[model samples]
Target chain A: MAITSDLRNVPLIGQAIQRLCSLAALSDIESHQIALCVVEAVNNAIVHAYDREAQHEVQVIFAQYSDRLIVQICDAGHAMDPKHLAPQTASPLDFDPCCLERIPERGLGLAIIRTTMDEVAYTTSHGKNILTLTRFLKSCQPGSARPEE
Target chain B: MQLDQRKAGDALIVTPLEDRLDARVATDFKERMIELIASGNTIIVLDLSKVEFIDSSGLGAIVSSLKRMGGRGELVVCGLRETTMTLFKLTRMDRVFQVFDSEQQAVSALSGNKG
Candidate 1:
């Protein structure tokens, strides 16, 4: 589904994330992480991509299979330079001083999304920036080594 | 969405913040803080146990509210979830505001202040 760049769209995106987590029957921590990722992604699209241009739309696609949940956020705004962004290493389960000191506002969203999901990839093509996040629901259990899919 | 207010002796307790404190709700949050300060509620404890997440705009709103309250009032935050706490630490807001692990601790600290 797609949503326009209205502030009202935030709750809708949040609700969608909740539904996805519910369907996956994720653990409490996992659910919260997913919710944060979804919110950050949608917020970035609205604040940076659309720049409050209500005429633009942020496209969200959710595809679920038996083992995985896939989410795609697509926008036609300016392509993002990933090199300037730093990855967030703060585990939701642990509080690290290094992670806490990095006060990154622009790149933290992408980093959190990357760390929480099983697989994260981004590409800019056709005047669009597409970010795809994949989570293997079955492999996310604690202490499980997720094999390459 | 609903804000519950009460007096814990000399300190005021505000609880159960609802809605995302982003650009949309920052204005309302600021207005409520200002109203509380104007009503002679000085030492304030904001129970943010219910706030799920906060953004930069929301962070700015809180800082602005603290400035508006001035030196007469103290704003202590309590019960921040991990995600919200991360935002605070990231912005160095943890240094700016005193944070407590529980509402009781926050209220007690405010009431115990000799100053």
Candidate 2:
């Protein structure tokens, strides 16, 4: 499914994720997680990928393998640096309850995507930034990565 | 992003009419919530029974709504599905807001009518 870079069309991603995950025999919970991750990717693409005036399009492709379901979100807006996706490490000594009070409500999109999807990979080629998220059908383990077949 | 609001024992019960609250309407949701706060109803109970899915933007909007309340009143959330609850827990927003199981419980807790 392809959608313009608008948040109003985000529901299509959920519908696609649900339909594809259902066909893959995923449980309701698993389906929901996949849908959430896809929604996050689409939202990121719509908000950050395109210029403020350009009407770029975002592409979502659903592929189901024997053991996993792969959803790829491709956008031509802006390429994302892989370094920003790396997990941040901070010292525990810097932690303060007051800091918790100041935690911004946003920026959890990437964390949610990483926590829900089994394997997440990003690549840019031919002026398109592709984010591939894979959810294993059989594994409930966190941070589990299966070699893509 | 329509919200159904009603008065219940000094607390305002606000329910979103949409099934999913995501980036599409997070800004509108925040605006309505702030409007509610401006109307002098500080104790608000958000009934999310109809909200099946909430993304980070939606969650952020709700957080900002809470912050808008500014310690004057309470913003209690109830009727969270397991998946939505997981999002709250994952983001640790569950600790920031007071969450209840049912709208009645939340209204009662905020209204000082625990019975």
Candidate 3:
């Protein structure tokens, strides 16, 4: 799916992703997690890469494997900082729960993607930044979306 | 984003009428929340019953509202969908906000604190 980098168009992408995840027989919660991760990836691309400019193009590619699901968000805008693709150890969620001031109000998109997906990778080539998110299937239903046992 | 706000004793309940709370409305939501807090609403019960999806941006708005309170008041949550609850748990916000099963319970809890 391709979008015009408008933040308002993001929720539809999440719904589409959830529907595709359903084809793989993912649980509602798992699907929600994957969809959210993809949404965050796209949001980051739009907000950071394109600077939230609505005219820019942001494309999302979804592929299902026998044991995992892969999503790739491709954008021709500015290349994202590779550090965001790295597995984050320190999280915004780690702050003191008692101190409201200590809690972070932003910078959680990367952490959510890192925690939900099994692996996240980033590569930039030919002016396109591709962020790949992978989530291994827990148990694929024996059907068209996966290999039958 | 439309919010249904009402008062119950000393607590103010704010419910987002929209099903999804993503980046599109996070800023607006945060602004509205800050305005409400500035208007001297001490205890806020964010009723998310109508909201089905909440991304980091939306969650951040709520956390920002809590910070706006600045320890001078209270902020709580209620009526979280299962997936929404997962997001809270993933972010460890479940530890930060007192969550109740119903709006009544949340209001009661806040009232109890005041009493």
Highest-TM-score candidate: 3
Q: Give the better candidate number (1 or 3) by lDDT.
A: 3
lDDT of 2 by residue, B4-112 (tens): 9999988899999899989889999999999999989888899988999999999989988988888677888999999888788777777777899999888777756
Just chain B of model 2: what TM-score?
0.95
Candidate 3: which pairs clash? none
Q: Which stretches of candidate 3 lie over 4 Å from their true place?
A: A140-149
What is the C-alpha lDDT profile of model 1 across A1-149, one tens digit per residue? 78888766777776777666775677655665676677767777777877867878888877666677777788898666665333454433233323433323234556556656788777888888887778887754434322211
What tens digits encode model 3's per-residue C-alpha lDDT throughout A48-141?
A: 9999999888898898887788899999999987875555547666788877678878899988888889988999999999998989887754
Per-model chain A TM = 0.74, 0.81, 0.89
> How far does residue A87 in candidate 3 sit from its true spot (Å)?
3.5
lDDT of 1 at A144: 30
Task: Give the number of the best model, judged by DockQ.
Answer: 3
Task: Provide the fnat value for model 1, as a fraction from 0 to 1.
Answer: 0.02
TM-score of chain A of 2: 0.81
lDDT against true structure, model 1? 0.71
TM-score, candidate 3, is: 0.95
True contacts kept of each: 0.02, 0.60, 0.84
DockQ of 1: 0.23
> If both were scored by DockQ, which would come out higher, candidate 1 or candidate 2?
2
Interface RMSD, per-candidate values to 1 decimal: 7.0, 3.2, 0.7
For model 1, how many clashes?
1
